[model samples]
Target: MLGNLIRYLDSVVARDPAPRSRWEVLLYPGVWALFWHRIAHRLFNARLFFLARAVNHLSRFLTAIDIHPGATIGKNFFIDHGFTVIGETAHIGDNVTIYQCVTLGGSNPTNGVGGKRHPTLEDNVIVGSGAQIIGPVTVGKRARIGASAVVTEDVPEGATMIGVKARSTLVKAETYAKEFMPYGTPCKEPCEPVGSQRVDELEEQVAVLREQVAALVEANEQLARKAEKPGKPACKGV
Candidate 1:
């Protein structure tokens, strides 16, 4: 148990630069939240539903992170900061990292039966702050979800998702693909909103039109100046 705890703390230290030592990592709210969740999950599996809920509530009150007791979490899972919500059916794989304000949310069941409503995150997946992975979608291994992304569909392995209703963007640098990237996205990735190309095209057209209008105005002013001069007269049919 001590060895496992040390490894878990080491994993967090590797991912987060804020902690100076393993003891400081112990003070993190996420570690405490996970500790409570381990006990709560065991109680839930034993059919001690009320007790599991009580522990979940206590953990949430202490850590500001709401993880359902029924959620399954694997080894070295790290939640950076707090305000993260993991639904009852959510399954998190080993070494998965979730940033603050991220939600592993569920969809409303039409038949009123609750079964696998939440998302499953594969191993080494990183979710950025405020990212929402809704429904029973599977985020494949090593996929990176960008900040404020809304993902409702399964994400392909090695993909980088960004923007509202997240879409995969081209991964730059094959060598850096497997490296641990902070915030689940590379700082240089050109992640943009849907239809960003069209928006760019429209902006270019508007700029061209403005330049043409400016030139027309300058020509009109030049003609007016020439007409106003005593030496110049308006041309008429000879």
Candidate 2:
């Protein structure tokens, strides 16, 4: 048990350079949250729902991280800087790192059946701050979810998701797999290509629409002139 704890602390130290020693990692609210959650999860599985909730509430009060007692978490699961919530049915695999203010939110079943309402995060998934991965989505292995992104769909393996409604970036996951990226956002070259091209394209389309509108206005004016003059009174009106 001590060995497992050491390995867990060492993993956190490796991921975050801010910690000088394992003792510093112990002070982290995320670490303490996970600790209480372990006890709560055990009680929940034993059918002591009230005790489980008591432990969960206590942990939340102490750590500011709310992990549902029924949530299944694996080894080395780390929540950085706390303020994260994992739902009751959420399943998190080993080495899954979640940053601050993220949610593994669940959905109400349309058919009223109760099971697997929350998301399943595969191993080695990295979720950035303020990310909301909603419903019964499966975040595939090695996936990186960017900060403030809203994901309602299943993420493919090793995909780097960004933006609202979360689209995968053109940059390959292998590029990120080489090293751990802070916040799961690739802030460098190759990840960000030339922009302004989309703006230019929209401008071109607007110009084309303007020309077409102008031509239609001119045609209407010419027709109005013809109607007003009546062209020499059409056979001189007898």
Candidate 3:
């Protein structure tokens, strides 16, 4: 507890010194939070849940970080900046990287009590800054969530999700695909050219229409000739 307190103090000092230096950010609040979180998590895992919760709340008050003791995090986890709000039910996998302003919580509109209410991120997932992954969904291994994306559903393994509500632009189809798949290969099979085939059929129909038009034009000319010079009438057109 004393060690965590000292580290928390160091983090505060680092954030607001006489002259703020970017180098000082190496030991920022989130960095210290990660260190203290491990301790708090261990305490929770050891059945000292009350003490762990107390320490977690105290740390949040001191550091502006809100990592829950119930959240399982891995080693060397660097919280790039502060104000990260990790939820109690969030299950973070090993070697997962997170950035500042990331929110891993539930989107339960009911606000009702009980049940799993946080996301589960698999190993080696890299979440971009200000990303909000909500609900009890699972983000599969090595998936990359783009900055400021709103993820609500399960992301397949090694997928890269982007845009609102997080659509997968690139899917890591196989475990070996990440290391071996060639560039320019389509994520799914290439779609056949239905448009070109329709255009060809339309062209044939247009040619038939043109021929009909030409025949009608000739027949109309014959009729005009007959009308201008009826059976024994004047040869001079009217």
RMSD values for the candidates in order, in angstroms, are 11.7, 14.4, 16.4
Candidate ordering by lDDT (highest first): 1, 2, 3
lDDT of each: 0.90, 0.89, 0.74
lDDT of 1 by residue, 1-238 (tens): 8999999998887787666679999999999999999999999999999999999999999999999999999999999998999999999999999999999999999999989999999999999999999999999998889999999999988788999889988783234666785544432323354247769999999999999999999999999998988874478674
lDDT of 2 by residue, 144-174 (tens): 9999999999999889899998999966676
Model 3, span 1-238: residue lDDT tens: 7675555444433323221433464457776787678889999999999999888988888778899898877533546567888887888886566777999987674868757888999876778889999989899987888889999999988888888978988656354334311122322221234446668999999999999999999999999998987476566676
- 122: Cα error in model 2, Å: 0.4
Q: Give candidate 2 regions above 4 Å deviation.
A: 179-238
Worst 10-residue lDDT window, candidate 2 = 186-195
Give per-model TM-scores. 0.75, 0.75, 0.58
TM-score of 2: 0.75
Candidate 2 lDDT (Cα, whole model)?
0.89
Q: Which candidate, 1 or 3, would have the higher TM-score against the true structure? A: 1
- Which residue pairs come into collision in candidate 1? none
Ranking of predictions according to TM-score: 2, 1, 3
Q: How far is candidate 3 from the true structure (C-alpha RMSD, Å)?
A: 16.4
